[model samples]
Target chain A: MRYETLREQIIALELGRRERQFIPIGLSAIDDALQGGLDLGAMHEVTGPAAVFFTQMILRQKRGGAFWLATSSPNEEYYPPGMAQYGGQPEEVISVCLPDTKDLLKVAYEVLAANVVGCVLLEVQKPLTQTQMRKLQIAVQNTDSLGLVTRGAHTGTTSPERESACGSAITRWYVTVVDWSHEKTQIELYLVKNRRGSPCRWIVEIDHATYDLHLVSVSGE
Target chain B: MQRMICIWFPFLESERLIRQNHDLATRPFALVMREANRAFVSALSRNAGNMGFAPGMSLADVRAAAPDMLYFDADPMRDIRCLQGLLRWASRFTPRVSRGGGHNLYLDIAGASHLFGGEDVLLEKIETQLEDFGFTTRLALADSKAAAWGFTHFGSTKSNITTERLEGAARELPVEALRLSYASTALCQRLGLKKIGELTKLSRVALTSRLGLDGVCRIDRFFGRTAEVTEFARHKKRLIEEEQFFDPLATNAGVEAALERMLEKLCQRLSGMRQGVRKSQLQLDRVDHETMFFSIQLTRPSIDVNLLKRLFLHHFDQIDVGFGIDRLILVAEQVAPLSCHQLSLENSQTQNREQDLEKLINELSNMVGARYVQRFFPVDSHIPERTFSRVAALYASRLEEWQSPSGTRPLRILKKPVSVLLRDGIEKMAPETVFWHGRKCHLTPLSGPERIEPDWWRDDPDWRSGGRDYWWAKADFGALLWLYRVSDEEKTQWFVHGLGS
Candidate 1:
């Protein structure tokens, strides 16, 4: 009886199409691939080298309070005041640096579940297992806030294969900085996995003056 | 602006335990004193008072109302010490702070009330800080000390005493507020005189004959006709708050809780003085006559009570409480005036950002070791490693103007450069692939050969190694690596210097 009642509500949201509502990420090609924009009220995993830039992109895309949950990895220190240079209010970003990845994930889940923040950006050194992703996914089920997990390069173990970090995320992205020169900072974003839309790729340019995400080319180009 | 502020602690003897262990803040508690065969309530907690328990009430009546309430023996000496400590704590607000009779404290703000915005704000600050330290207090501000003292004891609890309103407020209180002798009070009551106004209605000469000179004198003091002279103890420039536990605490949790209460009191004292602590000492007195101490030194003066508690909590593991910790004392060893930053209307957002960053830095320092948390400051050195130096995050530098990097640099740089391992067949200069991190480092040099010469003047051990030739490379394995080659007089060496996004 419980499962039936739960399924009926699930069917209800599906019929109403409220479950797929997204706050647009503001670029046509990216938005088209995302089936609208960034999926709302769900966890999305963004990985790779240029993930911080991608993380800050969502900060510019989303308004209101943004919680940046980082770890005490001396190498990967977050300069929140530097966010002001990124054209976002540094005061709006509440940065929390915890001891380990477990605490980081715990804080991320708690913050997302609370639904008090407009956007939560979690940068961790470890990839999320399926269970961890499910826990994070469960947290964002009720709120319209954006939960972005920016997975950094994990340097443990001997396995040559890259950990997919695949979980129950609505979408998974791999960001790579292709060009960071005196002229322009170009990046390649690969949509490795998408729950609703087809996988796609795009090359975007980070504007020098505005720091806005500009789509330079698509997969065909 | 010779404004006098009176702070009345109604339950000084009762709330000591609750102040130390605020867990009992809401629970009903009473201070019982026995005389002959009868027991009486000497003092009650604010919660107990709210339930209609007053000093001098019979213990039988108290237990009949609430049987499960906790009780303690009356300790006037301990209560006086606590009151004196609070009096000393108020010295942070003004130099003219003085101890009053019983549980009251007086602060001669004079011109200083405007320092906290106004008299009302200063009173609110005192009330809030004292309440945080687990005491219920009544506060009032008046032009004269007598009126202020009278207003707190006798005036309506909601009375906000200004000089203009002092006269009316003092009169509205009952004549018992005069603090007359028992016989005098009973005689006045027999005459159907329950208010101060009723006593003052009779001619002075008639009242003198009827109630003696005490009634006239009491009324005189209430009306501010005579000077309310009080000799204040000389101000102590140091802060030391101590608490004695009846039953020794056995756990680090309890020790931390005691330390937390101490920090709250210390911070309140420091906040009043507009000063912050640079170093503090926490001493633990054990039942075995062994005393243990831990010292905390902050990078800057900060009155953040919670942060100080957390910092002391880090050193909690080092303290060994044998048998049990009987008493805990926290002393501010080093303090400096922490002037409030003037808020600008146009730059409020920027200032708030700095404040948030300051709080965040303090929180991080408490969570991690002080050495582990740092903020970046651009150094005046061309050396790749010397371009930026990490300073304690608490003392964040205001100067953020960064000298533009001559070239793009890696965001994540290792503390020490990790040498790049070369495969047997790969060329040193243009190697297509190498080995690192238990995997083949598939290297693709995007930009390279930017030689950085070491500074000659600086005498440093780490930079003793010669200059380095750097490269920005994208590995085929999808990670960006900053590879460098160290130039040695004997032989040139290769190493993977840093990581980039």
Candidate 2:
């Protein structure tokens, strides 16, 4: 038997027919398709052109101490004031900036399992392997901590067959800009993978004033 | 009910010496003082006492008894300073804490007992904390200060008595509790009247006839018949805590521990005063008599001990204790009263989260250079980047408010504008295709020509090139760019200023 820690014990206690509690993303269609809402313990992989907007929206919802694993990547870096302006509590959010290195993944693992924080978010270009995902799955399988991993918009160069073949995430989403302008911004989220139900797509519009997201309608596409 | 607490520190001089030389703790040693070309024992360690050496004994007699025993010179000034440090440490329990001459600390813990569980728990805490600092103490609490002092110095080590039983406790204690002059005590001892009870039976007139009004008043004070007016030492505002060593501490960790001890005492005193440290410094005195100092200045005052410890940890390495540090000192240069907050269990989590965030910011700013962790504050300017100015994470205070731009702004604005070039000629109204940098970029205008005029009043550098017309455009791959052209027709140059989400 593996050494059972507090996190593992929490995960074990969550094993039942009851669904996990989630912080509301302020949207009905997305929340309904998400098997109620975002689970704290499970990894929700968000990838697409408009993923940063939705990720920030989801982050503003996780109401507690959050650890953001950021890098020096020019486009990937998280701006504090901008994030705060987008309805996130900048003071409650602490960003762990890592030097340019691959060890960020390993560091992310340690940070996730520590349980000293309420949420963990890591930005990466690549997805995890089956072994790494399996380890992460067991680590947060049943806790009330939101773990998020974000992959930037995939340029046509990378292959989807390798990672999308058997998605290890509890839920995997791909977002694309349907309509973006100063007056309004709309994103189409394709639910590429879901552990609890079938994959689907939802068109959502972000309220310019409050930044709260709302689903306009569901699309078969 | 008003209760008096007396903290009795016995043989403080000897303890101070032993603290500097911990090697003497287990050995038989005596602290000696020279008087008229003759050395007399002033204080003796536990082992020396067991071997039959007592204070005031001639050094020659002590030497005859144990020729191999060690002896150190007693510094009365050092003993007083160490006692002051203990007084500051005790102030954490009650703000009405004061010194009672050389070795006793007095605290008026009237209604403060309940705050620390009770009188018994409070006393136990004092004992434990003192023990941690390598001191042995006798503690007593009573309704009268004289009774507490009597129990502590002359009677027993532990005495927690109610006001009703103050007479009985005082009667059992000897005349030493009165703290009388040596001649008076000796005169009483020779008269077959040593304990206070024995002297109480004598007529007041008779007692006065022999020992005068001072002696009779001492007895009345002990019996609670007359009030004992103890001239409490005025509190020293310049709170400085220090520790000395005979064999200097060689490692940085050792210095850190000593510095922590000093900080704990200093912070405790500030907290007792309901004050926070605004500026403080740590001084490390080396064995070779060189002093090293590290100081910190805070924008807002704080009394958090752990926060002070963490801040000092960063500078622990820079302290050059050349020949090992023999002394550590901490001084609170400036302090301000801590504002009261209505504490609640619900807000405890929020409070802890805020504290953790502050700590993380401090540590992160220290880990990476402060520039890497930055927060932007608003500045009154028309330039996009100048609208908000970057400040070090360490210095960013509570942000008041940020004015949102009237129009849409780019998500990622480039630091420098990339100059755009016309594909065929410079006379075009808007470039259908432009040689932007290395690539032949095609630009389709989404919004155009928001003319911005230059402010001729001020000598502006960025706008000095000329006034510009701004446009939001889209290039290949749907990249949104903010393009601007110089207002001057002769130099109608276009440049990509920023990128939109």
Candidate 3:
């Protein structure tokens, strides 16, 4: 009887894994490379100069409340009116300010574990260990929540070994501004690590009026 | 005749300590008050009293007699607050409740007795509830406040004295039952007047001349000859639930279990009242006479026990159980009426999602702090930084619709603008090259010199450089920066305020 109960429990666990959904990024090429889209209950890392804008754009696609965690440093100011330009409602976004990186990650873990909000964005200034990243990964694994982490600008280059060391995140993207003009701003997203598919790059134009992402070019799968 | 009930807590201070830490109830406990650097027993438990320790006895003598006695400094203010809380709790039995001194509560249940059966049942109910709360109370019901006070102190633990028996009851009690001044009691004892009946046998003029008018009036008031006025306490009943444990809880799981049960009871009470809690406080009384307090606030009033439990358990690690926690009290400090909503058959998923969002907000608010988690609201101001304000997420009810400014704002704005150095002198409308972040970069003005002036009425240090002409400029590295130039009297200063992309 115990063996049969254990077998039934394993079946339920498998079904839960199969039922996990994917949140599409609204770009066909990028979504195709991501195997339909980003896994709904997983961690994704974004880093670079335009990483905040890219993260905000991805958060705009989700349906529920979003939490943005940042440190209390004077340099880390998030302009809500500017964020509204990226289709994030000022009222729907809950901004949390912690005193340090440790508290930022702690609150991020709590927010992800609750599985209530649709997305959590952590502005981490320091590098995280594999254990820290793995803890956050496990927190969001069972919930329909997305954990989006953006590294600080001062943190130097992301080497391949360091990327492989902290491989708990399901996907990692490096954002760079390609073009800026009065009409539109274009950013290049480099998918350095994808657990499910090959790495690729996509150039997208940000619509300031409608706050939508338009695909311009795709390269290097 | 008005019916009055006087419930006197004989060992108020010691019992309050015992109520908080139940382990002290089994031991000999006393509360000491120091006068002129000499400690004296102010209150003693029944066990300590049985061990021959009395109030007003020197602590040194008590320690010599009973070396195993545990004592603490008496806090009269906390005792008074406890009495006031009991008064509020007793208001459920009758609305006309008043405090008769530090450790006594007077209930003027003139006609409000039938709701809980009759007078005897009401008195019994009050006694049982107080006992359940770990208070040893002596309750008495009589026709007058003086008579009720006299009976509770000197007559019986529980007594119902009628108008016909009031005279005889007063006759049997001692002269101290009249509650006279200390000098009058001493004089009465010296004059061989031991009982109220003996004092009443004396002539009125003789009594007045010997004991003074106030003392004579005290005797008159006891026998219903004169009316006694009492100031009723304006007691407001709170939605509260609490539990006392036989064994103190030393583990987080035990505390969480007790908290969960208390939350269930409190939520049920709130639901019965058709109200929801907006802010609630949890107090843990440790075995060492210390208290740990936590306050949980919600984004919206909620009666959901699971949400409250989750919010509270998130902070369970912070509870330092000094020795152990013997009592848990949950009080809803702020509540609002929650109108019942019929669940929509089709849109229940949406409702559940919204509820989930609220739970997330509450949990995040508690994890950091309510003030640290905030939502932004637009303000009707023209200043760049003053255009929006961050309000705590839990308290942001009605937010103004965000109206985009005419000029395009940047995705990230610097908290304080950084000054930029222009290589070329301030001759042109805009500088071609500027040094920022210790790097000299060429600037190409993409969009414009949108003029923004500071609020003239307010003194702002950041905006003291007068009006600024903001420009969306591009650096040589293809990064968009929000640059603004402030032309002061002496020189033209340029500052990079934000990042555009």
Specify the highest-TM-score model's number.
3
Which candidate model has the greater lDDT, 1 or 3? 3
Model 1 residue runs over 4 Å out of place are A1-26, A32-44, A49-123, A129-150, A154-171, A177-182, A193-199, A206-217, B1-237, B250-279, B288-323, B341-357, B421-429, B459-467, B486-492
Predicted candidate 2 versus true structure: per-residue lDDT over A119-195, tens digit per residue: 77777766667777666656665556778877764232222223372556777877665556565667677778866
CA displacement after TM-score superposition, residue A192 of candidate 3 (Å): 2.9
Off by over 4 Å in 3: A1-16, A152-166, A210-221, B1-231, B245-247, B397-401
Residue-level lDDT tens digits of model 3 in A56-145: 777788867788888988575888788766567767778899787888788888788888778888887765777888788778778888
State the lDDT at B280 in candidate 3: 92
**True-vs-predicted CA distance for residue B173, candidate 1, Å:** 76
Tens digits of per-residue lDDT for model 2, B402-488:
556645555445556677686757766775677754667566776777776666787777778877777876664334566788746
| Interface RMSD score of each model | 5.5, 4.5, 2.6
Query: Docking category for candidate 1?
Result: incorrect
Q: How much is B101 displaced in model 3, in angstroms? A: 19
* Chain A TM-score compared with the true chain A, each model in order: 0.83, 0.80, 0.84
Q: Give the TM-score of candidate 2.
A: 0.51
- Best of the candidates, lDDT: 3
Ranking by TM-score: 3, 1, 2
C-alpha lDDT of residue B39 in model 2: 92
lDDT of residue B261 for candidate 1: 81
Worst 10 residues of 2 chain B by lDDT: B363-372
Give residue B112's lDDT in candidate 3 (0 to 100): 95
